[model samples]
Target: MLLTPFARVIPLPETIMRCRYSVVAACLIASFAATAEQESIERLEVQGDFRRLSVQTIAGSIAVVSEQDMQRSSAQHLDDVLSQLANINFAAGASRGRFVQVRGIGERSEFIDVINPSVGVLIDGIDYSGLGISSIAHAEQLEVFRGPEATRFGTNAMAGMLNLSSKQPDFRRDGAFSATVANYNSWQLSGMLSDAISDQVAFSLTADKQVSDGFIENTYLHRKDTNDIDELTIRGRLLYRHSDQLQWQLIAHAIEQNNGYDAFSLDRNRTTLSDEPGKDKLSSQALALRSDYHGIVGADLMWQLSWLSADSDYRFDEDWAFVGIRPGWEYSAFDRYQRSREQWTLDYRLVSDDQGRIADNTDWVLGFYVSGRELDLQRTRRSGTRLRAFDNNLQRDNAAVYGETSTALSEQTTLVIGGRLERYKDDYRDNGNLTIQQRHSMWGGKLSLNFQASEQAMIYTLLSRGYKVGGVNGEALSRAGDDGLEALLQQATFEPETLVNAEFGVKGAAIDGSLVTRVAVFHMWRDDMQVKGWLNPELGPEFAGFIDNAGRGRNYGIEMENRLVLHPSFTLHVSAGLLKSKLGPYVTQAGLDMTGRDQAHAPRFTYQLAGDWFLSEQLTLQASVQGKSGFYYSDGHNARSASSELVNLRLNYQLEQWQFAFWSRNALNQDRGVRGFYFGNDPRDEYAPHTYEQWGEPRRFGVTASYQF
Candidate 1:
């Protein structure tokens, strides 16, 4: 396979090149003058490598992004970091980067009903699955497993898994603080400190706060902060080494967000007419304990226990504007939703030690997982002075046992197999005072063969199966009319969805580690695919949405990633993904045929190119170009977003113990849409349908200063 040429290229300033050469020449002379300190400097280089480049491959397709990479990109959110990866997309809703879609699978909304997300997310081993607001200010590493991780993560990982590891306390005393000021009246303050409390104990703490006057402007209210943001995050960790072979860590973290959510407008621009813009708020906390023991005979044992609690409020102006915009329309409303969730999880695992002969030839692991979750939801709608409300409660319990083993059959060949058996149950109750219960048992697994073609390359193939549990539509049933309440209850229940996927890929490091590349091709078949649909409520004019088992679907894609170290001071990175999707012949309950249509949010192509140049020991420059081909927004509607391209840049300077950086996002100021919908939101049009879009961020630049001690 050959590399594809970049879509566009812009030339750099000649003056910038001259400045770089001058700095490089001065640095070379300083290097020659410090020959006696070469060994000490080399030691420092190796220590930095341990901190920034240490990586472990979990599965064939898993990718790990280091902390240094995150800092280099100046990523304030997960989407900022993942936007540069291959085969990844995000569905931005009323808030920021909420739902993530990977390899053309995942959901876009969870407004009216509870959903089982295809992608799983974990922060320090505590599940934050569908929530996307956790701060990454002190994260050490991010691992993305880009396949069905059923054997390890169970149902929630039917598509993939995202794991975030926070920085840990070490036997070194260090601290750092940073402040950033950017456009749109945005500023951030963050700091972290770590110290060794004793010979066997260490402690670390991190805190950060971010504030921004958002992009959108409310024309009616003459306000620019209607969609603003304010967020805070804090975390603490304690590590204890009980003995040479045993260690344990305790972690606690909290996050608070108060953000406005006025994203839509009738004109599809960055200005809105809403007079009563709503707010999005969240308060979340988590605690976790992990222990590792290496003293077991020929095996290592690990245990983890975690608890998470979250409270969220999401509201919006039901009407884009107050009445009087149209002659005959005089209607206004407000909608508010409050939700709280609590979850507890426990996991235990054992793996063979690699020191023994059997372990050297074979790798094996076994694990058990158990979790329980509870959720309470309340919704209120107001029209004039009239108000209507609904409340619901949901509970879920899950347990699974899984195992995997790989053995070397020959010098160049290896075979791997893994499987998981899971049991899940759900209970729900709504304002109608009726209770619904459901239970499911599922099996998922994977099989693969890996071949080491040469010292510098390897090729592999895999087949995997995964499933998503089903649930009853309690809220929809509660709103059912009296004529067929029984029949509607039965019709509202949905079955589980299953997927079978096959993939082939090759990865290699060439030119003595100066260049690295990975490519993968995959095909997936879905059975009884779960889909969301909107319809008229049985008893009201308000529309309602629910999950259903649509017919089958198929998806296929190719992804490629490459990194080239052209010189000691220059590096380049490229990634590209191509996808195709189709739905089998199926008719929705609303009498619409979605056959032959692409899956929602599944873009046909996504690509990114990035370059980094180090002018001298104190100066660095980075630039990136990212683009995505557009796709449909829903199965029931024909609305589509246009393809978009964006450019970003960052420059950094270091002097002794202090660093200064300047960064710009969306430097091109492209007008792109991250989300879209085709529906009637205004009553003045007599419910006539039209397209609306939520625009992406505009061009913004910022400066940062940091100090280390």
Candidate 2:
């Protein structure tokens, strides 16, 4: 099938544009620039006074969450912080927020075999994509990029990127300790210490532990803690300064998790009938080193190297109830999966020094990246006394070279261009003596034009291309037909997916820095879109699912974010996003026409409103409300989640060296669903298809106390 082109843009009403321009003009005329700068001293420092933020993606599409914002929301995990944004969603897999989707594009399933991630995750310069175990207990800032990052991140960043930075070691000794107590038998403890060990070296260490009685209840086992939470994280870093022009940094981190996996029920409630519950355990360790040198022939050079290893044990009950629930039916079943992975990465870059018109007002950057990963996965399925086993080993290697340059065409106009050439290779080997290899070479890049319309306003446009590598399915060998195993393997392989995106945006600070606003419109066209589907044969009870290239698709959206400082002690923030995603003309393997179908997890509209009020020097209040429209769960099914809204509040009291806070999440106790499926699990119904859902967290209130020394 041939790819389809995007439709023409729909023009907006002229009156709307006139009204926006009028508002901008009025704000400019009535503005009074503030001469004095305000600074915050809270643990999660507020960046309200800052008008500009930096991110490593397309210009004007960056969203930054300050430390104070995180604390106000009482964010325990990454999802807690991300939930307040627009055009962003996640799938609740074994744990919370295991997979993230951006702008209606991302992975929705767990990594069962060889797969490529659409979103890229980075923490303190180390890659952690698809591994949501990174602790945010001591983060300094969170930056989210909402479009393809081909030039900087390569194939894995086809959708977007999320970057988290921790507080750096300082010259003075500082430490903090915090504790929290909440409902549902939940509690947490965290600590951080940083000190200057010598004149040339500084060290920092952080640790966190959290425990909670999970929300689900296994009625058959008569226990509420069957699906509980137990997690721990530790990190250490050292910074060494050889001289004013040279520096080196080393970091090491580890995470341990032992969470429950007993989610879902036949009745779509919190109570389950499974007699045998399962566990989700993970242990991971990573190390990274970075070196930087300045004044290298009027340029700067930096190098980074990292290594990571992780082992996971994920098991669950396949049958929702005991054997006696339906006599003479198929016996109960269980599935256990053990996975181990090792990865290594290297990145090096050189940047030219900025010279005032000496180099024609131009700046340039060049970089090279390489990564290697190996995975070993084993699965065992048990049906009563009978057992079936499968095992596979896969290896992936990637290398890329990229370059970008920006030059001033005039005093108000600047042009930027960049490109990346990448090569990817994958090898897979199964225990059944079957082996397959795939290789792909592709190029992607960006072209942008930025115009400074005024001292307080700027507008920009960008055209970018992103790509995801292809792979072969290792599980399809079990269901090979008369065509033989090799032929089936060839049919199971999928090609690479690619997208071309175009965006136009305007950003400015109004009311003399008291207000900041951003508006953007984007359209993306995708080719060889990858989709998952299940196949059942008439000859046997075996069922197989695999990823395939689903012809083409298109997505268009508009996003806006505005922050206004109504007064010195009062602030308001609002954000909204509207999206339309549709699959092009395509025929599925089952001979079904999927044209005009909405993509999975693609919400139509999302919005948020947040406010902060400072009553006194030692007391403050904050509240936020976020909502999302219902969306399809998958491309193969029509099931969807219901529209829902969530409210959160926080109160804070601070004194010299001490802080106390009270926070509530889901204050209304909205029982919204975060994950859903349409597969039958009850034998009493003869395995009929029925919708099952995993609900989001209920209302919870907590108190936190912290001390600095």
Candidate 3:
């Protein structure tokens, strides 16, 4: 299906796409014919919380993808893992998805201005928000905590949080190496090593490199590597047992991505006509230090310090064709944006010990957080005989203090409350003689009540609030308005946005601990919602972007994650998200009312069902079905993506010290869209509006081999 403003009439063959359903049904029936002994499901732990708790004790949705799951599914990148989860979506305006959205909220992309991410990303305590770091070489688990985590993570986690933990040294001598060869001229090599240097010190190191000639072909330039992928990641860690009363750990990480960025085309297909194909490149390094002290009287003391530095260069061809290809009908232009970013964060916390409780059967925690960031950006544009450059810099600081307390009202009931007080300040400057200063005081809190209905089931209710700081709206506010221009210039900033969430959940196990499930329903209200809009594109860059506050918005959704151990060697998993959203009351600078429309990149439904079957002691098979409903591409345009469906499979075999796996993703070879834009960019049609799209990955097959020692 095609969705456009002027013309929205196009379709792909239904028969070809519908075959995935038949394949799924056949696999399900086949699994039922084979059986093994009953298996007992074990409870997983939540690592990002202030307190150590089981999955069934959480009041909201939490999804954890372990190393075992990644190995069986061949999930080489972070994007691959996100696609298998529920209530989550990512936007890929660049070479890969750097911006993430959870529960119908978050930023899609950033070109000229800085963004405050709604969904936060942290790997081994180093923040990677708004940066796409694809390699997951030695990750132990990826945890997705849905809903507002304001008390725990602050404003950056208004929508949710993605916490990735790396494998720690257990004072053991172990190692592994893996290699893979896949279609699309793709190949990868990764390895991990762990060793104890001394009785008091241990270390673990990981490194990975993946390269692929991406799927797009530049027809005009006769090149197939225009949209290629080249990424490398390395991580090193050291653990020190300072004394029996204290422990310390240090980690260092580095990432380099030199991926090409020539995806969009006039024909809106894999073939492109760009002569000046550009690149999306990044170089980043991070350091993190953590300490845990058990000698602090009646409480356990924990603190972490992390620092990150990144330099990125993103550029693209403004004109998607070679010079003189359309002669007088075309213009030759290229645009680039370069950024240098540095940030550091410190977090300190004290968790109550068994004997530290202020009252009987009660627990408490206190934490303090501080962060500082500096960002510099430069934009270079070359069009026709004109060239221009713009530079800007931003510095921001944040500080917060938070506390949480859990009281057992009775044997079957518990009450939990948490709150935080935060302060934010920023200074902005530009070479264009623009300067702005802003300060804000924000607060957030949560209240949850849990009832242990029975040994196998628990019910809970939660209420939470989250806040995001405001910033300057240079592009939109700088433009001259009618009678409102004077009033707008007086307040050239967009106010901060806030969200209040209410959730109810039930966690239970059935079939004698063989089945475990978590279900949650949440409704969120957005006040003074900050959203991205567009000005008239015909006016060019000086007046292209718009940022403002929408009065009110609402997002409500239901999420479920279930695991069933049908037999000792067979486990089935199902997850889904159903969403409904409205944009609230607002009109764009282009005079378009977006009051009750669905948010951008927000699909109505997403689902995944997977089955793992061990055919024998040495052989296993994994299959899954994943898909999402249709959704709009952006806030200012009507261009939307067609619903998509895919099927994935993997087969594994093992021998002494050696293992081999064959995998296929999107086996049905369906043509689906991942990014879309409705704009007037074509020269032949005199720049008439047209809907354009960037396609997702095609059918892929790969084989991997690994040796463990």
Candidate 4:
């Protein structure tokens, strides 16, 4: 379907001419504007509790939840609160922390090296996307950024980014504890404390635990559903201010989880039985240090170094025979598979002010990065303890220097130009066998014209380029199909992914800060896209897969976000996104036509709306609704289709030193389906069934109360 703005009454030719004229006029105006002037914007904007946050409403999209919002909710896990976001999707597997899918590209692909996640996650300035680094503790604020961003965050930022800020050490001695009991025998306990060991040194600690009976059914196994989950997290941060110009912090965090291994069964009718009643454990630990310095050659510098380690012990029972004739008939598949990982990263930055020097036309930044990862695995058949050990490692080194400056070309216009040069390398291995070592270097540039159309509004047009690094496949598909399936799984070197993005947008605030709105339209063309594909059965389709070069793709979309304050006690927040993603023609396993296919799991339309009504100074009520209209789960034309709509409600009341809140998700009891496909022994036989289904959560409600003291 072709999507165009609803109010395009003008003819196509005239519209194109008008847009070209506008661009020419904008450039002309920017050329005669003022010279260099230093301008800095705050990094974060905060509203009342539970509302989204951003630095520049139109520059990027950000979602933030302060401590107040965290304390008012009954949610023990971070994903619980994130579920309310329309673009944020999760898949519950054997692990406690669900797989995060943001902006449609995060679904599982056939290649492990191609981490399709366009989103980058950061905790305390440290990137956290390694195995077993999902659970976070005592977060003070969590920020989510959407769209192409490479200037602020180096790489891996294809679609968006997620940054989490931890609570800082308090000079005052304080602590609190809380517990809860809910349906399904669910229970939770949390505590936090902070104190100053000295005037210049301080520290804080936090710990939490959660246990619940999962929501599922298994008639074959008469006990409660095996989706039960238990998780614990601990975190600590120490800050030292040695002198007036320098400050540093040391932080450590850990997570331990024991969960049931469950994958939805093919029983067709029963919604339960999707969860396995098997035991699985996953854990991770990390430590990092950050330093901030002033007066470095008249510039500011920030540096961070981090090291992390993780381990997973997972085992499960699988159906050996195709017939379900016997009772308690179970075959152990991955009787036990152990995985361990270690990673280290170093990041440094330097920022300088122009200050009317060098024609006041220059402002720049210098940055560098180094990261490494290693994985060790041990596996054995469930029926026996004959262990097989394998080792794999990945090392990436990236460096970039970017300088973006806005020279006031005129009083009403600003011209901005910037560029970045980056280089990266990846190395991968299998079972102590080195497969491939690849390296690449790329450069990106950005140019923008910002015009203050009026005091209340600003219009900007930007043309920029961004790149996502390529990596070695972490999990090869060779183990998936077997007998012959493993042979088709081939390991091939991959090239980098790059995109050229063009955007035009407008931003405005009306009614004296009572209303704000922003709209933007963009088109992105990506090259050398790395995507997972199926192999021909003649090659012996098995689980082992290969990484191959995929053709290019194009994405065009529009995004709009608005906030309106109707009264002192009432406010509304709204956001919507429409996207069309299509890949170029490429040869399939059967050599049939498969062009113009939507990227896997990327939705065409997604939107969100919410209203807040403050009943009184001590009480507030909120109603929110979010929906995803169109999504395709696979690249194959015959793959399964999936979509969802969810509504949520929350009420908060505060009195004295205590605060309380009641909240519910999927409040309207929507039926959400999570589907996957399994194609066996049939590449050319497109007539075979290649889809599976598992239902998502139903309506759930809970209340929370917390004491400040």
Q: Candidate 3: minimum summed lDDT over ten consecutive residues — where?
A: 1-10
lDDT of 3 by residue, 58-89 (tens): 77778888888676557888777777888788
Top TM-score model: 3
Greater-TM-score candidate between 1 and 2: 2
Whole-model alpha-carbon lDDT for candidate 3: 0.81
Q: Report RMSD (Å) for each prediction in the order shown.
A: 8.5, 4.8, 7.5, 6.6
Candidate 2 residue-wise lDDT at 470: 88
lDDT of 1 at 287: 97
lDDT per residue as tens, model 2, 138-166: 77678777777888788877877777777
Local lDDT at 340 for model 2? 93
Off by over 4 Å in 3: 1-40, 474-491, 510-513, 537-543
Per-residue accuracy of model 4 over 1-709 as CA lDDT, tens digit each: 0113212422232323334433344333333221213233223453211123344433434455555444333345655555445455544444343445555544343213435345667776666653323444456777665556666565656655667766679989877666666666677777788889999999988888877776555655664556676888788899998887799999998878887655445443223332234566768888999887875664667778999888877765443122233334322233456777787888777766544223665455566666776656565443324444444555556666655565677766777676777777666666635577778887776677777755545667666677777766544432433454454445445566777767676665552455656665566777886666554454322233445456788776666666777898998877776667777765554464557877766667777777888999899888777777656555543565456677878888879767677877678877665545544322234224445444555676777666666
Q: Which ten residues in a row have the lowest lDDT in candidate 2?
A: 42-51
Against the reference, the lDDT scores of all candidates come to 0.77, 0.77, 0.81, 0.60
Candidate 3, after superposition: displacement of residue 358 in Å? 1.7
Candidate number with the higher lDDT (1 or 3): 3
Per-residue lDDT of 1-709 in model 1, one digit per residue for the tens?
Answer: 1111101121222322323333233323323333322221111011111012222112346666776677766877786887787778888776687787778788887664778888878887889887774577867777776768788788988888788877789789888999999999999999989999999999889899989989999989999998988999988889999998999999998999999999998767999989889898989999999898999887788888999999999998877786666656546789898989999999888877776326578878788999999988898888778887888888999999998887898997888889999999999888877788999899999988876655445666778898888876755675566333333454577888888877766665552445666666667788888877655423222555667777798877777776777898998988888778877676655567888788888888999899999999999999998898988887766789899888889999999999999999889899887788777766566766777888878998999898988
